[model samples]
Target: MSSSEVHLRSTIGGVSVEGQLHTLSVWFILALRLMMGLAFLQAGLSKLLGGEFNAAGYLANQPASNGSPLADLFVAMSEMPLFMEFVNVAVPWGQLCIGLGLLVGCLTRLAAFWGAFMMVLFYFGNWDVAHGYINGDFAYMLVFLSVAAFGAGRILGLDATIEQYDVGGQPLVERYPWTRYLLG
Candidate 1:
């Protein structure tokens, strides 16, 4: 790390960059959020609408490799038909909510966090067990964290609107001080 890095001021699409990477990062966050959000939304909706959707089959079909580290998860989840059924219903809905939230910039941080959690679960249960080479999940996780870290919701998002919302004739923050944590 040297203090030699110098950012020459530049402009793109008529917007000033001020030699700061933050300007570029804003666009990247939006793109990444949409990518992750839409993927989850479509996947969730497909499962719910597809009459033949079943988690058991998917879980049970995991190829056994190196003692099958994911076998326990598959077995435990499959054994309980009732729980499986619950999961079948819950997972899709959760995905849909997370996708919509991230897509709309509503509760963006929470949505990103949940999306990261789901990615983590899939990474462990699927890629780790299969010894897969694809590392898209890692990329997705990083993007989610980045968006959350930068408070992206305030940029062209409902979070900005929600933050200024008035409750009982007072701004949300003034009415409920604790809402500062939840608004954006």
Candidate 2:
């Protein structure tokens, strides 16, 4: 590669070049990241502010006799009031951290992975509400999973710069194989 080409590649994440705008997929990924981050931020702030964020009450109100897998889990968890309190506090903070990480494009892959896990918890928690599909929770989960799979961070985030380094080009990344998808 020419010297100029090497410089360009090295600076990709540092600054946006005039003709090197991100692709449509990158833009879509950015939008999804922002939306998911905002959603989690709002939920976390509401909980922190004591704005009727009552998971226990909501779980208790669920129909225990309905034989829903989620409901059963909820009932079991509700039995431990202390555990519920911990969850109430932890859930909000976890969302806040994950949301902020995604928003700032810091640790994008890790954030997406955690976001997906959270979505799974949400999906199971609300399984009875939508019959296991066609819900915001499921949609969010899928989106996060996609981001994790694609490593969308490299498209326009700090990961793009990070990847230029030797560590980012390590065999682990090559073996994982998904990192290449993020290069776009």
TM-score of each predicted structure versus truth: 0.74, 0.68
TM value for model 2 = 0.68
Q: What Cα-based lDDT does every candidate model obtain?
A: 0.72, 0.69
Residue pairs in candidate 2 whose N, alpha carbon or C atoms collide under 3 angstroms: none
Q: Which segments of model 2 are wrong by more than 4 Å?
A: 1-22, 51-53, 63-67, 128-132, 162-184
Q: Candidate 1, residue 74: CA error in Å?
A: 3.0
Over 4 Å off in model 1, which ranges? 1-20, 63-68, 128-134, 168-170, 173-183
User: 54-107, model 2: which lDDT tens digit per residue?
Assistant: 578666655454445677778778778898888787788888877876776667
lDDT of 1 at 139: 70
Clash pairs, candidate 1, are none
